[model samples]
Target: MAKAKSLKAGDKVEWETSQGKTTGTVKKKLTSPTKIKSHKVAATKENPEYLVETEKSKKLAAHKPDALKKK
Candidate 1:
């Protein structure tokens, strides 16, 4: 696999979903464990997750760096 891209807030990114590909904007980088609603974000400084907001639904989600493609 390719090296994961570095991301920050306001960066555009995309990821796959059951509904197919979805696009969103990075809201924040999670360096420690956190929660999104009832879902626990198992994040770490070495393996962080990104909080993103969907362009359409505006729903919030957390995804690992490798799981997101920076655009």
Candidate 2:
């Protein structure tokens, strides 16, 4: 399999949603379990998730690194 994308904060990325694909900039890299809004984010140091702000709505959401494609 190909290597997973290494994303960092401020990186422009895109991910798929129910509406379609959306673009965003990475706000932070979650390296530990944390809560955002009411959702429990189960991120870890080895396997991390990104907090991103959507381009259109500017809403924050957590996404797996694999789910994001660098732009």
Candidate 3:
């Protein structure tokens, strides 16, 4: 099995969207359950998620490490 990628703040990443792929920079790492813009995020220390800001729209979204690709 392929090892999952490890991401950190300031890392450039991209993910799939309805309009196509969206690129952004990692703003923060979430290790605890929390909400972002009304979206519930289930993150834990062992399996954390990322908060990224879109380069174009500056929108924030939470994404799992595996769902993001370094850009």
- Candidate number with greatest TM-score: 1
lDDT of the structure predicted as candidate 2? 0.88
TM-score of each: 0.91, 0.90, 0.88
Give the alpha-carbon lDDT of every model.
Answer: 0.90, 0.88, 0.87
lDDT of 1 by residue, 1-71 (tens): 23347888999898989999999999999999999999999999988889999999999999998889887
- Give lDDT for model 3: 0.87
Candidate 2 lDDT over 1-71, as tens digits, reads 22226777898888889999999999999999999899999999998999999999999999998888888
Report the poorest 10 consecutive residues by lDDT, candidate 2: 1-10
Name model 2 segments beyond 4 Å from true: 1-4
lDDT of 3 by residue, 1-71 (tens): 22227777898888889999998999989999999878899999998999999999998999988888887
The Cα error of candidate 3 at residue 4, in Å, is 6.5
What would the TM-score be for candidate 3 when compared with the true structure?
0.88
